[model samples]
Target: MLATALSASIAGVDGVPVRVEVDVAFGLPGLTIVGLAGSAVLEARERVRAAVRNSEFAVPDRRITVNLAPADLPKEGTGHDLAIGIAILVASGQLDGERLPGTALIGELALDGGLRPVPGILALVAAARAAGARSIIVPAGNAPEAAATNGVAVHAADSLRAVVRHLAGVEPLVEVGPPGPLRGEHQARLDAPDLASVVGQRVARRVLEIAVAGRHNLAMSGPPGVGKTLLARAVAGLLPRLEDDEADEVRRIHSVAGLGARPIGSMQRPFRAPHHTISTQALVGGGPRVRPGEASLAHRGALLLDETLQFRTDALDALRGPLDSGCVTIARVDGVRAIPARFMLVAAYNPCPCGWAGVDGHVCGCEDGARRRYQARLSGPMRDRLDLHVPLAPVVSGLRGRRESSAEVARRIGVAWELQRRRQGGANSALGADALDARLGFEPRLLALLERRGRQLGLSLRRLHRAARVARTIADLEGSSEVSRDHLDEALLHRPKDAAA
Candidate 1:
């Protein structure tokens, strides 16, 4: 007898449908799984067999062959355990195959028949819906996430017995409720470290605001304890919350990474701050199995590199590609997997080896050659990618003054973001050269000023265009329709090269 069950596999942040076909015949009493099954997947046969026996079902003595369709597609994870077990039951005539059609199943099976939650439930639900499946059976623990899908019915099953009973028409598993109507924008309530908490560096704060409004990358150079890290965290808080689509994408990436039960919808933008000692693979994402790195996890959010100069130069340089392309492609022996990484980069570093190169309070203990080499860790190409650079000066007693709260700053940022969205259908940072030309046709004087500055500063065509984009964002913040010379000039001051040199 032959039976088939439906399952799903995750690739990047999306899901791929996989058909599990089982054949039981009068031959050697053995089980075989085909279709490029990974080690974990190949190990599912024992899990399924033990689960069936533990569920008080007879393990048929006939030889069984399980084949995952689309044999070329590499299948990983134990998500197929339940589906394979169910297929075996049907092929053994213990359960009817009629109910299997138009249904997809996803769950890991324990030796005792319990249905364990698996990663990528959201992606699986998405795949099932796209595959036109009438219903999907998932572990009870994963029901909420799977039910988030609107058009499909989701059946929550607790164990193999429950699933078998439901499919056999004895007792149906409980149907999961449809997800609530698109909830209102998730408000970020976590009181982000307030900008007012920082003792000084007013110039740095203003530059950060511009960077947040424009989705521009920023670098902060200062001695330790001058609020560089605090300022970066505050800047993340100042940015507007993610929209519906952006939130969904962020949640999906988190889900795939197995970060526990995320809110069904959230507006809080992701802020990924990896330690300096992180591996190149961990930073860029590539192992025996390719998974999303820090860059991919920070998609549509902020990636803060604290102690930026201390990190591996190769790992730091790897970011240049994703920073420009908004996606990181991991080339594996099997194929290339592209993960979205459209995020604003924020890095903090000391001015020199001793971190006292320019600070007034501290002595310059490091020699010039050492200072040059230390600063050289951050390459020119990498520095050029940053749109804003602010040198954080040492905080003094007199420098401590009243500063704006995150709420007030966020409101201004939200207004600016809305204006950009209305004008260009996207954020200012994502605008292309043609879009800049069409939407932000600058004033004649401003254009001439930008041209002259480009020559004087020896800016590449890319850098010049990016500066104009930032200037446009500055104009948007002021509710101005046209980019002015003042905006252009301020934008130039924030360029990384202007400070790094």
Candidate 2:
């Protein structure tokens, strides 16, 4: 006898449907699982057998052959344990259904028959729903996460016996609906660093708001004690909540990374600030298993690199592809995988090795060689990718008047985001050269000015395009329909020829 159950396998943050086929026959008592099963999947044979026996279910004393079709697809993780166990019971005549349709199973099994939550439950559920599964059974611990996906019925089971009882119609599992309000008690914006805390650096604050508005990459260079850290962190507060599709993309990525519901509260965008010591692989995502790295983890959100000068050259340069293509592409022996990495980059660095080269009161201690070495980690090409640059100075007095709160800046940012979405369907940074030339709402006069400035400044096409995007964002912030000359001039000021553009 043979039985089949639907399951899914995760691949580079996406999910692929897999069929769990179990065949029981009269032969020497043994269990086998084929079809490119990873070590974790292969280990499920012992787990499923133990879980079934411990659940007080009879295990047929026959050869059990389990195949996760299609045979060419590589399956990893222990998510298929429950499906394999249930299929075996059905194949051996211990259960009624031989073929389960419109239903999918996803869970790791414990030796005592209890179902355990598996990573990527959201991705798995979404995949099952897309594959036409009307309902999906996951571990109780994963119920809330799976239910967040919506559009599909989620049935959570605590143990193998519970699933068996439901399948047998002895007891049906209660359906879990979508969890209301992905946001937590306080909104994410309220919890992030408030812009009012930093007493000075108005220009840096303005640039940060523009960066958040257009999702442009920004770099702040100053001595250690300046408001660089505070200004950089304010991006989280200014950032708009993830749009529906954006949230879905973010959830799927984090879930695939096994982050669970952590760092996803209030349905806020991710803010990943990896340490400077992180390696190239850890920064860009690469290893034997090829999991998503920090860049991908910050998908549709922000990736902040504090002390950017101390980071490894390889790590800093590795971001060039993602900064250009909006995705991190890793080519392994198996195949090439492009992980989503559309993120706003917020980086803060010192002026020199001693962290005080240009400050008014502090004198530089490091040699010119050391300063050059410190700055060289961020290569010329890499530096060109940053859309806005701010050179901060130390605070001078008690307060520079009254600084606006993050909420106030966020209101303007919200308006700018709506303007861009309605006008261009995305942020200004996502615009292409063609879009910059024709699509962006730049004043007719500013177009020729931008081209002339590009020539005088020796700006590349990439830099010209970046300047146009920043100008458009500035215009959006001011509620101006057209990118005025002042907006372009300020945008060009942020992208100096000596630095970025």
Candidate 3:
């Protein structure tokens, strides 16, 4: 007898539909699984056998062959365990296979026949729905994730027996309702550090607002105690919760990365601050399984590198591609996959290896050659990608200027963002070169000044465009109808200084 069931596995943050076909013949008592199965999928044979026996069902004493189709696609993870088990039972004549059609089964079956939540449930369910599955059965614990997908009836099954009973029409599992809205946007939801608490680096605060408002990449260089870390962290408080479509996309990527239910902190925006020691693969997205790296994880959010210079040169260079394309396009032998990495990059580092190279009242400890080598780590191309580079200094004295709360700052950012969305349908930083001249309301004099100053400074077209975008954002913040000379000059001033500077 042969029985088939529907299932799906994660691939590049999305799900690949798979058909589980089990054949039970009256010859030998061996169980064989084929069709590009990974170690975990192959190991599912033992798990299925034990789970079937534990669920009070007879494992047919015959040759059992399981084939995951389309057989050409490689399959990984224990998510196939549940579907494989169900197909085996039906092939063995223990249950009817009629209910298998138009229904997808996804979960990892424990040896004791209980179902365990699987990662990438959102993408998996979405794949099932896209593949014409009317409904999907997932682990009870993953109901929230599975429910996040629309156009499908989600059934939460606890144990193998419960699934069997539901399919047998003896006991049916109740369908899960759709998940509630993701937490409210921005400051209302996140308990992040308040901007008002940050004593100084007022310049850093201003740069952060412009960076977040337009989703621009920013780099900050300064001495050790210049509040670089504090300002970068406060970016979380300043961020608005992701829009609905963006939140769903981000949640799917994080789910495939196995961080869907991480915490409420991510509800607002994912703030990924990778350490300096992170590997190139870990930073950008590639591994044994080619999973999403920190960049993709920070999609629709921010990726902060605290000790920017301390990161591996290769790892830092790897970011240049994603920075330009707004995603990480990884070419692997299996195939090429582009993971979403459109994010605001925030980098904080010292002016020199010793961090006091230019600070007052502190003698630099490192040799000039050593400092040169340290600064060289941040390659020129990478620096060119950073839209703003604000150099900071320590403020040892008491606060002099007024320190506005994050809410006050975020309100202004929100207004600017709304204006950008209405004008260009996105942040100013995302404006294309053609958009540089379209409807941004740039003054004729300001445009002439930008072109003349850019040529004088020998700025690349990329830099000029970035500067223009920043200028547009600055104008938006002030409710200006057009980009002025002051805005253009301020934007140019924010450009990263030369490595020698």
Candidate 4:
């Protein structure tokens, strides 16, 4: 007898439908799974056999062959365990095969027949819905995420016995309702470290506001404890909350990573600060099996590199491609997969090896050559990519005066973001050169100022364009229709003079 069931496999963050075909024939008792199953998946035979026997079902003494269809595609994970078991039950004449069509099963099975939650339930349901599956069965723990998909019927089953009973019509499972939108009435609250907390770096805060409004990359150089890391964290809090569509995209990425609860729709943006010891592959996403790296994980969020000079030059350079394209593509022996990496890059570093280049109290201790080498760790090309560069000064007691809260700064940022969205249909940072020129009609005087500064600063063509874009964002924050001379001057101040040298 032959029976087929529906299942799903994950590739990157998307889902692929897999048909689990089982054939049971009279022969010596044995079982085998084919079709590019990974080691974990190939080991599911013992799990399925033990689960079936423990679920009060008979394990037929015959040759059992399980084949995951679309043999060309590699199947990873044990999500196919339940589907394989059900197919076997039907092939062995213990259950009706007629009820299996148009239904997808996704779950791992324990030896005692309990269903285990699997990752990427949201993507799995999406694939099933696209494939025209009438219904999907998932573990009870995963029902909420599965039901989050619209226009798809989801059934939550607790164990193999419950699933078998539902299939046999002894007691049909209840259809799960749509998951309620994330709870918490104050979900819009953004509790970021306020700019006022830093006391004296008024200029740095203003530049940060521009960066947040425009989604531009920023870098900060100062001695330790000068509020660079704090400023980066505050930027995360100041970013506009994820919209409904953006929230869904973030949830899908987290789901594929097997992370916990789906993110609540909060205006609080993500802040990812990976340690300097991270490998190049870990930053760019690569291995025997390609998985999402820090860049992808920071999608629609912020990627903060603290002690930026300490990171490997290769690892830091890996960000160049994704920074320009807003996505990372990993090509492996398996295939090519693209992952979204649209994120704001913020990096912090010290000015010298001793981190005391020109402080009031601290004297410079590092030699000129050592200082040059320390700065050389970040190549010119990489430095050019940073849109805003602000040198932070140490926080003094007098400078730590009362200032605005995160809520207040967030309100201003939100207002500026809405203006950009309405005028440009996206953040100012993502605007193309032509679109920027058309929308941000720069005054000839301001254009000449940029040209003169570009020549004097020795800015590359790319840097010149980026400077213009930054100036455009500054104008947007000021509620101006065109880039002005004042805006261009302010934008220039944010660029590191030493970097230009």
Give the winner by TM-score: 3
* Candidate 1: C-alpha lDDT: 0.85
Task: Give Cα distance to truth, residue 33, candidate 3, Å.
Answer: 0.9
What are the RMSDs of all candidates, in order? 1.8, 2.3, 1.8, 2.1
**Candidate 1, residues 150-232: lDDT per residue as tens digits?**
78899999899999999999999888996653455325446558876777677888888889998999999889888999988
Residue-wise lDDT of candidate 2 within 288-399, one digit each (tens)?
A: 6667899999888899999998899889999999999889888866678788999999989887888988678789999988887787778989878989898988877748
Per-residue accuracy of model 3 over 201-242 as CA lDDT, tens digit each:
767788889888888899988999888988888888787767
TM-score of each: 0.96, 0.95, 0.97, 0.95
TM-score of model 4 (CA atoms): 0.95
- lDDT over C-alpha atoms for residue 325 of model 3: 84
**lDDT of each candidate versus the true structure:** 0.85, 0.86, 0.88, 0.84
Q: Rank the candidates by lDDT, best first.
A: 3, 2, 1, 4
Residue ranges of candidate 2 with Cα displaced over 4 Å = 181-191, 262-266, 398-400, 437-439, 496-501
